[model samples]
Target: MISESTPLAAVEQAMQALLDDVVPLASESVALGEATGRVLAEAVEATMDVPPFDNSAMDGYALHHSDAGHTLPIIGRVAAGDSPLALERGTCARIFTGGALPEGADCVVMQEKACVTDGHATLPGDVPEGDNVRRRGRDVAQGSQLLGAGMRLDAAALGHLAAQGIDKVQVRCKPRVALLSTGDEIIEPGKPLASGQIYNSNRPMLVALLEGFGADVIHIQHVPDNAEDTRRCLREAALAADIVVSTGGVSVGEEDHVKAALEALGELNLWRLAIRPGKPLALGRLPGGDGQLTRFVGLPGNPVSGYVGAWLFLRPLLGAMQGCTAMAELPRLWATSTFGTSTGPRQHYMRVRLDFSREGIQAHAFTDQNSGVLSSCVGADALAVVPPHSQVAQGDLLECLWLKA
Candidate 1:
């Protein structure tokens, strides 16, 4: 019953219990070029130095610091693809950006800062030692660990590995999640729904949401509200995938059958959360098909409520499977609210839009903020969060979670 009211921590603890049983669904080796957004299964150690050697930072002259102020002969030229260079005293190489610096050269003087006349360049600036010099092994030394296990790949990290000459990496496989919706009053899209049935929008919305989280929804099916059939579908889905997410029937209503089904199979736990629009959601596990066990997330029926639950809870668990160490940490952004608002004992997610100008950020809350109205979510750039029982002033600092989620 969760009569005492479920705190956010309780929900988090429940989520952690389910995630403890999670392992990468499967793994496949991928070339480093295609590994962006993939989860690393093993630590990636640098096999060679990044940049491999000292390199030019700009199209300039490279020479020893002893020749910083005096004229040096333009003895050679080095572009991106030329062979290794050798340097001598009072010698400067016309080096292009990304070209390796010649041996014995320690600094690069920008061409704009030097006057070249008669094959000799006069450096005007007092360039410091190691100035503009990307030393050998300075960025990342050979045999050093570049990224650790459980690190999710991002663009910057990928560039780091590419600079180290790593062509491939071992990554945690993406998990396959199965989606199923149960209710007698639901109908598939593209067909005109009958009087008692509504077009199933939640399924499609959840499908895209799961995909955005880097999960593969292998199978999404519609199960009738009938108890036995719902049980059978859930049973099969549990065995078929690592996690199964159902969008209805968790509440204690006559049509609700998920609780009974879970009880029939294994242990079942439910929480009536302290958050508005998501109090009816539940989580549990059972012995699924193929003699395997799996985690289950039962979200509310309202489209926006289901989405909120998916983002707040399901996103973190799925992220953990993808090797992200801090998946549950939501982004915290700050803004000033345009108007004061009332909050309940339960936490709330109010749709908000931000205005950025010379006046600074002004957050405007949506007029229609019902959880059933998914329209507010369509163009929402942020969510203005109010902690439990807090009263906000018009110009008060407010936490706005960005829609990047």
Candidate 2:
């Protein structure tokens, strides 16, 4: 188990240790209608060329390049979807957009340049070969790998699959996650709060965030501060889902029981990290309903810390379970700091908004860096990483992570 005083760098190592034991879920074929946002389990190859045949890129006259400036007989007209026609030596075809080029035609001249009168078409001089023509397989070649395994199917991917006549695709199953919110002081929203009780906002926020990440929340329950109750809820979550995420009950306080509960059922792989607001996080695995191991992640109680923990840990964990290699790292962009702050012993994740300027993007940290303040995240564009024990001055370049899609 990792100690509470472990360095921030070790936290990443511990996270990787947990990921090394992750086993991606099984794959299944799904219809195109339900494939969006799903990870592809198998690579896709183009069965046919994108264009399939040589076609016209515009409305023009299809003829041989050597026939320029010569009045050729207009033997036939071809529109889109028309079968290819054979052209004779002094003849040209009047073609519309996407019209298939005839066998003997090697070039196309725009209709504005090709004046047609009666049954004859006149082309201008110097009309280059292959002009205004889209060659077969120019965009995508047949038998080429178009999409690789573990790719998240978005609109463009779906369209590419449709272009290849793929009605169904093999994709990884969605991860089933269980969320547990602990602490006796936490009360459900819309209900009157008793003495010293506050409304629970982490449940809904995490639920939406997990759903946005393409995870299915199989169970979401509120566990009290009692150790026995926490253990029972954790056991149920481990049995019901592929991953169990718990908020609170990981600190060293007497009320914190998540770590003790995890130790009872399994091992706590990690205990704390050297990061501000989200220092207390636990990761482990426990026996699942099927006798396999179920992943467990314990997040801090503070709302902001919980959000950050989920962003840095849970998102990538779920992605790994879905076999997405790209999601192994968080998306980061460089930005100049518009403001500065004195550093402490731990790494700081400041909620900030980014401003685009002529020079470069700039990050401006929120006034209140408190973990419990949810207002700081409302207009925040990203979480700017500030290293420990370093003084940051204005105009300093910093690495910023995107918080929104």
Please report the candidate that would top TM-score against the real structure. 2
Off by over 4 Å in 1: 1-28, 68-71, 355-362
Please list all clashing residue pairs in model 1, or write none if there are none: 239-289
Task: Give the local distance difference test score of model 2.
Answer: 0.88
What count of clashes does model 1 give? 1
> How many clashes in each structure?
1, 0
Evaluate model 2: give its TM-score. 0.93
lDDT (10s digit) by residue, model 1, range 303-327: 8888778777787878877867656
Model 2 residue 324 lDDT?
Answer: 90
Worst 10 residues of 1 by lDDT: 1-10
The Cα RMSD of model 2 versus the native structure comes to 2.2
* Overall lDDT per candidate, in order of appearance: 0.80, 0.88
